[model samples]
Target: MKVLLTGATGFIGSKLLPVLTQEKYDVYTIGRSNLDYAKHTKLDLKDNFAIENLMQSLKPDICLNLAWFVKHKIYWNSDENLDCLSLSTKLMKEFYKNNPNGIFYGFGTFYQYLHDTHIGNNLYTKSKIKTYEILKDFASLSNYKTSWGFIHNVYGKGEPSEKIISYLITKLRNKEEVFVQNPFNKFDFINVVDIANQIFYAIKNNYIGDFDICYGTSFTTQEIAYMICDILNVSKDLIKINHQSDQKFEISSKPLDIYKNINIKDRLCEMIDNL
Candidate 1:
């Protein structure tokens, strides 16, 4: 299968590339920077004409859309979210136009769920929800086979320093105080490698529709912090938990058991030791 991947240099995509290659798929990547492992095309996703032209030429059997504006706290309200949403939708349309029988897989977020309480309401979340809806609707109209994977917190080595896991790991390694504002906030963290494997599994099985790419487990901020502290043999007292901040809970739909063999604590330990 000829696979086209966006966000090839990202935290998840970087890990996913090897998995696809190991499966012997002819992979092509699009990114701002050139990827060393595969046939990479350096192109800006925001340019519709360039994207359409590339899609027409490649006509890949599968397109995995993972590109987005993912700057830490700023992405919640950044206008780049809207721009990414538009670009992603345009890419999907072009992909369909070129390869009618091609499969398209989109990465979604847990924040897309509409809860009565506006805990996760933000520009980034809203953009993801809107983008997924638009793409899914378009696929339906065209009778295209599409899969939407709603992901939770994905953590691994080589993540940006601004990410939660990276931040915690740094502080813990330095024996510095880790201040967590919303200690009660619950999250489900899946290893990036596990996420990549699940994506491969879904595509291989020809599964379609919405699925949650997360380990069927959730943890509070304090619990996760202490787990890191325990692994690093650091003082648990260094973790300061403030209960005043708004606590967000991410609920998954159709959670998968693909990551049952992996232990979260062991993963944290390995990441910390590597740092």
Candidate 2:
């Protein structure tokens, strides 16, 4: 299969690239930076003309759209979210124009569903929901296969330092005190490798539709902090919780039977040790 991948240098893309290669798929990666593995075409996704030309030339069997503005704290309110939504829509149109029978898989976030009660409160979540809605409608009318993978919190190596797990690991490594707000907020954290594996499975099995990629388990901020402390052999006293800032967030009520065999604590420890 000839696969066209955007954001190939990203945390998930970097890991997924090798998996696709090992599966003997013909992969062409599009990103701002040149990648070490697979054939890379360095072009910004914002360049619509370049994206169109690339799509016309490659006409891949599958296009995996993983590019997005992910500055963690700032991304929720950033204008870049809208920019990504626009660019992704254009890219999808171009891909379908050139490869009508191909599959287009895009990434969504758990925040999109979690924030349904207060839609448009966060630009990132709103943009994702809008993008998915628009693209899903377009795909239905165009008779192309499309799927949206709603991802929960993904923790693993090569993640940005601002991400929760990476940030805590950095602070612990430096022996700095960690302060957490909304300690009671529960989240489903999945390892990047498992996410990559699921993507592979979806492509290989032709799983077409909206589905979540999560660990099927929820962990509180305090629980995860304690796990980090235990892994780093640090005192629990170093971790402070701000009760005043606590807010209850919705956890996934959907059953995730796909990852039943996976042990999250072991995976968390492995990630912590690697860091």
Candidate 3:
């Protein structure tokens, strides 16, 4: 299968590259930087003519888009969200126009499923929600085989430092005391590799429509901290849990047990030891 991938350098997308190649996919990546692992084009996606040319040239059987404006805490309301929204919509339209029989998979955030009372005013969430709405119409007109993977709290190597797992690993590895807010708030985290695997499984099996990319297990921030400390063989006393009401804006997403044998602790240990 020929696959055209965006955000090939991102956490989840990076993992997908290797997986797709091993599955015999002719992966062509679009990004700002060069990647020796796949056929790559360093093109700016904002250039509409360039994007249209690439789509007609590649006409890939699958388009995996994972690019967007994302920062630590500001993405929820960033002005860049609007730019991403516009760019993604244009990209999808061009792809569907060129290869009406191909597949398009866009990564969405868990915030898309949160109650309106929690994220109704959120631009990032609203944009993602809107993107899926557009995707549904496109699928109807095309091959009717599109995918939107709703993801949250992903942890693994190369993950952003702002995430709780990365934050705890950095602090605990240094043997420094770390204070955790939302200690009791439950969150389910998936390893980036597992996330990539799940995505490939869906594409390979021809699964369509909206799906949640997660482990279907919830753990508190404090619990994750302790787990990291245990893996590092550090004293658990370094974990200071702050008392606060849980952020109940979580969504109960369905878990596809594609990687049921995945061990979270083992992945954590690998990340810690490699540091």
Q: Which RMSD values do the candidates have, in order?
A: 2.0, 2.2, 2.2
Lowest summed lDDT across 10 adjacent residues in model 1 is found at 111-120
**Whole-model alpha-carbon lDDT for candidate 2:** 0.84
Error of 1 at 104 (Å): 0.8
Clash pairs (backbone) in predicted model 2: none
Error of 3 at 85 (Å): 1.4
lDDT of 1 by residue, 1-275 (tens): 99999988887888888899999999999988777764999987778889989999999999999999887677888999999899889888898899999999999887776434465578888889888889889999979989899988888877778688889889887999988877776778877878888898888887789898887778887888899888888899899877675646656445655665567888788777665
Q: In angstroms, give how far residue 176 of model 2 lies from its true place.
A: 4.5
- Residue-level lDDT of model 3, residues 1-275, one tens digit each, is 88998988877888998999999989999976677763899877678889889998988888999888777787889988887878788878888888887888988987776636544469888988888888888678645568889886787877678677778889888999999986766667778888899999988987778888987776777877888988889999999878664454455767775865556777778877765
> Each model's TM-score?
0.92, 0.91, 0.90
Lowest lDDT 10-residue stretch of candidate 3: 244-253
lDDT of 3 at 247: 51
In model 3, where do residues sit more than 4 Å from their true spots?
115-121, 141-143, 243-246
The TM-score between candidate 3 and the true structure equals: 0.90
The clash count of every prediction, one per candidate, is: 0, 0, 0
Question: Would you give me the overall lDDT of model 3?
Answer: 0.81
Q: Tally clashes: model 1.
A: 0
